[model samples]
Target: MDEVLARQAFDTALDEHRPEFGTFFLARLLGLKISYPDETCVIEFPVRDFLFNPQGSLHGGVIATVMDISMGHLLRHAYGGAGATLEMKLQYLSALKTGSATCIAKFLRRGRSIAFLESRLNDANGNLSAVATSTWKCSPSADPTDGKRVP
Candidate 1:
């Protein structure tokens, strides 16, 4: 592993993490660049060796986390509230060894209190790597602008 890059990633996460938008710790650690293009939430990130599994591929858990964040960010952006993931399922279609990957999350259905969302992760070459579908419980009382969890 590249110790310098790993340390930089850790330092960046510590220095830049916030509760709002795309500034979360995990996002920083993964060097994720998040954006809203049209109605979808997109996250592009580098594939670091530190995040690789024993077999030398990007770890499945890391992929799943990015997929989850994409959906959650979409919920927060579109609804002005945060969401609690009730359940999520993922399918890994391929392994990513190098280059960056982009995960795009979109809503399948949005309701008053519940939502269905899906995220697709593709390699930099535009090959599909994984897909995730999830159900979320919207916290209607949370305010998106303030980035505070309502409880």
Candidate 2:
């Protein structure tokens, strides 16, 4: 699809699904399906031409964005608020040629003002393709530390 149509579709979805869109409009554009269960956040999406590099592989930025979103999603679920990425490191083990893939994020630690999370991205065949670790500082708007003491 062209950029105009893509933007229009994104606008339509945003209008229909307001206030609870996961991550951002790009995820919606990229067709990311997000799920939460127990202590993990999972996102599955297809690798499309728009998200590919010149070499015909999934872009590194796309992988990083999914990883980052997974971590942020986990922090929001566990802490009741989204977070800002203070830092993150990613390792791209292999290239994804095509098809859908999955990203699973789990919390390493949830602190008063910061959270640590890790995400693993698996290819369409369910083989590990990339991994990332990130630290996020709880945003003021979503901070769970408003005079509430941690147990």
Candidate 3:
């Protein structure tokens, strides 16, 4: 592992940490760059050695987290509120060992009290590495004072 790079990542996350939107700590730690285009949410991050598993590939948990973030952020961007993930299912198709990965999310369905979303993770070369679908319990909005979901 590149200790200097890892330390720099940690410092950046600590410095840029925020309680709202895309500036959450984990997102910062992973150096996630989030964007919304039309009706979809996209997140891109580097595949670093510090994020790797013993097998020298990005960890499955990290992949799942990125997918989850994409879907959750999509809900927040489309609607006027954030949502709690009630459940999520993921499938890993390819191993990512280098370059960057991008996750794109879109809503499958949206309702007053429930939402369904899907996210696809692709490697730098545009290979589909993983996919995730999730269900969320909707919230009315976020409390600006504390960044908590308001119902």
User: Against the true structure, what is each candidate's TM-score?
Assistant: 0.91, 0.82, 0.91
Per-model CA lDDT versus the true structure: 0.91, 0.82, 0.89
Best by lDDT: 1
Better of 1 and 2 by lDDT: 1
Pick by TM-score: 1 or 2, better one: 1
Local accuracy of candidate 2 as per-residue lDDT tens digits, 1-151: 2467557657855765535648466677677889998789999988776667888889999899889988988888877866799999999999998789999999777668887789999988999999999989986556554555543
lDDT of 3 by residue, 98-146 (tens): 9999999987777767788899999999999998999998787642224
Judged by whole-model lDDT over C-alpha atoms, candidate 1 comes out at 0.91
Q: Model 2: how far is 102 from its true place, Å?
A: 0.1
| Candidate 2 C-alpha error for residue 76, in Å | 0.7
Regions more than 4 Å wrong, model 1: 142-151
Clashes of each: 0, 0, 0
